[model samples]
Target: MYLVYYSVEISNLSENKQLSCFMHLQVPQTPTVIPQELNSATSTSIAVYWAVNDGDAIDCFQVYCMEELQASKDAGALVEEYRVTVKESHCILEDLEPDRCYSVWVMAVNGTGCSLPSEKAIFKTAPAIPTINAEDCTVCWDTATVRWHTSSASAESFTLEYCRQHSPEGEGLRSFAGIKRPELKVSLEPNVNYFFYLRTVNPFGTSEQSEAALISTKGTRFHLLSDTAHPALQISSKATVIHLPEKTKFTGFPSVLGELLPARGCHYWEIIVSACRSYRIGICYEAISQSSVLGLSDTSWCMRCCPTQTSSLYRFLHTGVMSDVCVTEHPARIGILLDYSGGRLLFFNAERGLVLFSIRHKFTDAAHPAFALEKAGVLTLRTGMELPEFVKHS
Candidate 1:
């Protein structure tokens, strides 16, 4: 054939393609500027952004990410490597560990080869969800102290969320944010069941909500049942107080029963008596008739106060039998303590810290707090009270 291949010249090929033909194609220039949007990062993913050099030809981009080593010497043991290929200038590295430091770099790639990796971009993913330390959480009548723990060393802050357990979702849900420590104290309603959870936050974003925990605040909470009250008894709108008008034609005892009862655990409440001449405050079986005088039936026990001009006379009564109790002063405030498991009932002069009377009886039936006003007076009920230390010891 006469050596015709010697004279042919190809000028249409680009410099890079020519270099590739000669096996000397230059790699794309390394990405010079990589800007990290910290807010775009999440617990398990990170977004990386870089700029491609305008003068170099690029086909695809390669992203390399790895967990940063705490010690340089042990880099090979603990490091986890991740790589991805993309046609765009940005990529989201997925399935990364939460709350961990990572080093990332980008390389412009072409048919020839990949460029050197860009300067390492170091960042930390958002913190992981926190766990509520149930054993460390404590609740009282009106407040709760909650504690939590996290595995994330990068946790910047914490948030606590709570709501009444019975309330609808998002209703009455409250949050405490920007808590630097893993603990928080929240004010809450007494004797209410509440649901709680925790979340961790970093500069990147907030973690997912932790598993929820349920707790009930301590103390007894109840109100007078209007349906169980005598017709003449004037019950307050909130049903926390009852009044017997000085003039009324009702014939039966002005009595009422509390709306709730404690079948277990020790419970306490208070009653404010406003200048009453005669009244009966006690606990009785819920089946007790509203017309029956409190303390006069076998199902009830009470402390009856009948004050004379000279002094206040008190008596402990049950099943129509009564015993006189000596008192040094009139009591305007009375405290009632009932320990169902212990089978103990006690009445206290709340202001004087004097034990007015006590009875030990195995409660065979569900008991409701009962009140009766023999004469015109106001009786305000106060529930959700913590048991006194003296009562606990007694």
Candidate 2:
């Protein structure tokens, strides 16, 4: 190897003498891995930048790129190789294939010749438009939790648009700022199909629109399995909503009952008492005694809220006993999770996200959802996504 030297001339003022010193410096070594601007990548180009940190001066840089071998299929994808030499610290490679991943590296060159290649930087060119297969998207009750993955991760943010099939276009999707995790929660129609789409945007530009995603929400679909509802109580034709008479014949007894016979598995469901003056919602076994109220039966489990009377309080009822809970609020929905094999019944205040109470019991047989309404109001079986209290989903 040949050695190159650098000389510096210095003057000693006190001694009135001039001296020169010669020093040998190493050639520009390998450059650090180039930083890629993934968000700026397009179907045909990508921008990469590097920082200068070597002790020696850099004459120029050469950026090398090649297409990555994809899984399956042969490795004969005629990838046009790129060998760009530039005096600047950055370069924008052109004529790249869309949606194709590529391996890139850079080397620094100076008077001593070129340095070793840098660590490879992997990236993919974004498509003209965002694309989604809508793999993990789900619809529950009157709300749907939508999720998807883009063909390229270059997108900085996403715009989701969704609406039920029967409604006019552009009705429900809310504004979400970041696209890091591409997820959206929106209201939908129960038992009805809906359509949705997605688009990605970055500093470069907005990508093309994603294909329309289609799904259906699980609407109120439970039926009354037992004839325990009082003859006076008005049950809806769908068997999901119930109404108590203006003057309730019984104060704490069941106003309506459902036929959900859960033999196994952790069952989950909810009921909305937004318009009710008072309600007692829970699950009960078939052998539960028919009495003044469901709570008085040893075989029944329930959470009660009496809002109409002077002393309207929230209570948990089981085994002919009552325990005081918190005062109930409007828009209050009750969610019940009964783990038969686990021998536990968990109750939640959907409006507050509070675990009001949980009961552990060895269930003897199958159980069903039960309701007791006091005064005039409607209790609708909520067959939608049980939302957290933080979400303002009407």
Candidate 3:
């Protein structure tokens, strides 16, 4: 079968006898030229534009070298041979080498295929920002600490500030001077999370904060339970079972279908101690399963280790087993982890609640249902018959 495509035909009226119809009429894409005045680059602004012609439905857009566009000046480069997209057209490309020519263009694509490249445009990138490196944080505490860093050499001096991020709205509420050694130390809390902002000081004013980043101080050594599955949380086999002080709470209900369950329905057990010197808590079990194991009828409900005063209480409304241990140490931040092989394991965090940051891990066999509390402290195993490997508390 032969394929035929019809082009738009136009005839002028009042031409007398009859309007002559021309075949093989060529219709070009709308705009043949795009005009944009290059503006001064700043800490925040960048250039962005839409480059499509003839009202064609676009599939995707691309940016390519202008030289290629000039080589095929008639149309433009094909869809493939390019780099980068206008993903964030307003994205500020930092750390550019001074006085360099950069060419950028956008191409539109449709069902017919990729459209001709847009008009080629060239712009020079600004000079690189002066070099400067901040000092790593030294001292830390439960709440905050002091931090310092060097100023950019090219700058006469630098200004120091910090915020959760680098936006006009996020600009530092506070700023400090850095005139000597290019160093300045700011105070911070031990475990508190924060963001540090740095800028170069020239007569032109402060360059934007290098980049927005999140920084958390090291208050105490904690283990991470890694599992990306939703509503799933896991812990290293080495968390101590300390009694959360009275009034301790957990954030969310560790549920399978995202519902919190009754606290009284769950059993509460604490690690027993021969003496009173154990820092870590311990428990006894062959393996955690989805079935009638660990006295849990719901296979989805697994064991969770929670800190006494942490925000986890805000995530889940239900309470866990209120063992005497919770009345004792009252650890503030607790870690949740599990190994569910025959069944599934679901863990939740306070901020995310029934979602985000949950981890789950499945195991084939129960090698170590019982773990030695390496991080928390030592304790006597409670809740199961016949301790497997009992370690005496001093």
Candidate 4:
């Protein structure tokens, strides 16, 4: 019966209604960030913005991020962080990490809490695209080393690029650019076949190429085949030159052939004679016989030249037998190595390193590279070379 005791002082009316609900619950007022949307960043994503400052006591928004540790001796033990939570005021964040440098901030949140962080900002991202370990490349016969990789630490430079896998689209492409190491050596041309790739620059941009890698360089590449020449021989629209004009007369065997010979390795080439009286240079068996005569056939092998007003008479034919070699000097650049699985076949005089003849035989078939001019001269076909440390130590 003391309901009247409810003269209620219920603790001063619950302390005046908890001080009027803490004066309408405050706690949101520090947002301002903004300064990293350089067109929405990218390479993994970033974006972020701010400015709100008390938008009706917020109620959402957090962000945060960090990173920015490009090894200042592993800055503060590799700073990391990251967070998110949005509801607007901008936010993209995403898997990020490419060419990094971040920092960011923001905050806001509400049910009466969070709101003090907002000044940091800074940013970078955008520089991932490397990949090109093309099985770690290596080559050699003219050089090649290549190699690449990048999840991005903001690659500050690197370009590479290449071409020659049938060049002609931007013709022999080639590029190098700043390059800050991810490996590179390049020079290549012996046996060519290239195609490489890899881009990734920075200062926040340039990356979108990597993923090509083909590489071949090692030795052996062919050229002359003007429809298997001999209509008085003339091939040279890039068939690597060969001419015979002094009144072309060939009842059938002024020969010419090339473009095959790589069933194995070790090859080398060159030829450049102009001022001739007889010529032969050799390798054959593409089913020889167009009225046959290069080295008198057994499927060919040669080295003839014959000019003697007192200066050039070398021989070494095959099958029609002939041997006579004993020069001391008389070479207009001839070189030709071919080791096809080691059955050897040499003949250099290439600028007087002198050695003019060698043969061994054992090849079973598929071989080509033959030529014969007999009179009017001019043969010129150099081909990707590389195999001379004196022909690999003789």
Q: Which ranges of candidate 3 are over 4 A from the true structure?
A: 1-47, 51-54, 65-81, 84-100, 111-116, 124-130, 133-172, 175-196, 200-394
Point out the higher-scoring one by lDDT: 1 or 2: 1
Would you estimate the TM-scores of all the predictions?
A: 0.50, 0.40, 0.25, 0.33
lDDT tens digits, residues 264-308, model 2?
A: 544566887777867788887776665646676777888878664
Clashing pairs in 2: 129-208, 141-383, 141-384, 142-384, 225-259, 253-293
Candidate 2 Cα lDDT to native: 0.68
* Candidate 1 lDDT, 1-394, residue by residue in tens: 0111123335677754432222244678889546566567788888888887787768998888988876535645856589999998888888988877788888888766778888988877888888985545544445666888899887889989988888976687689889999888777776678889888998887788899977667666666789988888899987788898887777877888885564666668899985566899999987877667888889989989878777888888998767887565788899998888788999998887778888999887767888988888899988655566777677
Query: Which scores higher on lDDT, 1 or 3?
Result: 1
Q: What is the lDDT of residue 43 in candidate 3?
A: 33
Taking the candidates one at a time, how many backbone clashes does each contain?
A: 0, 6, 39, 1
Against the reference, the lDDT scores of all candidates come to: 0.79, 0.68, 0.34, 0.74
Kindly indicate the candidate among 1 and 4 with the higher TM-score.
1
Looking at model 4, the pairs that clash are: 99-154
Q: lDDT by residue for model 4 over 1-394, one digit each (tens)?
A: 0011112233566555532221355677788887764435656777777888534557788888887776554545856698978888887787876767788888887776777888898887778777885545545356667877787765777888888878876576679998898888777776777888888777655666877887777544467778878788888776778888997666866778876664456668888885665888888877777678888767888888787786677788888766877564567788888776688888988786667677877777667878888888788877655566777777
Candidate 3 lDDT, 1-394, residue by residue in tens = 1122555434555545454443342222422224333434433322445534444444455555322233324674453333555442223333333333445565554444554666666644332233322223322222222333433333545555655433366454576665444445455543345565556554323455554334444322221112210132223243322222233243432111111111111111223432322222212233333222221322222333444453222122112332221223333322222323223222222122222122232333322222222122323322211111111100
Question: How should the candidates be ordered by TM-score, best one leading?
Answer: 1, 2, 4, 3
Summing lDDT over every window of 10 consecutive residues in candidate 1, give the lowest-scoring window.
1-10
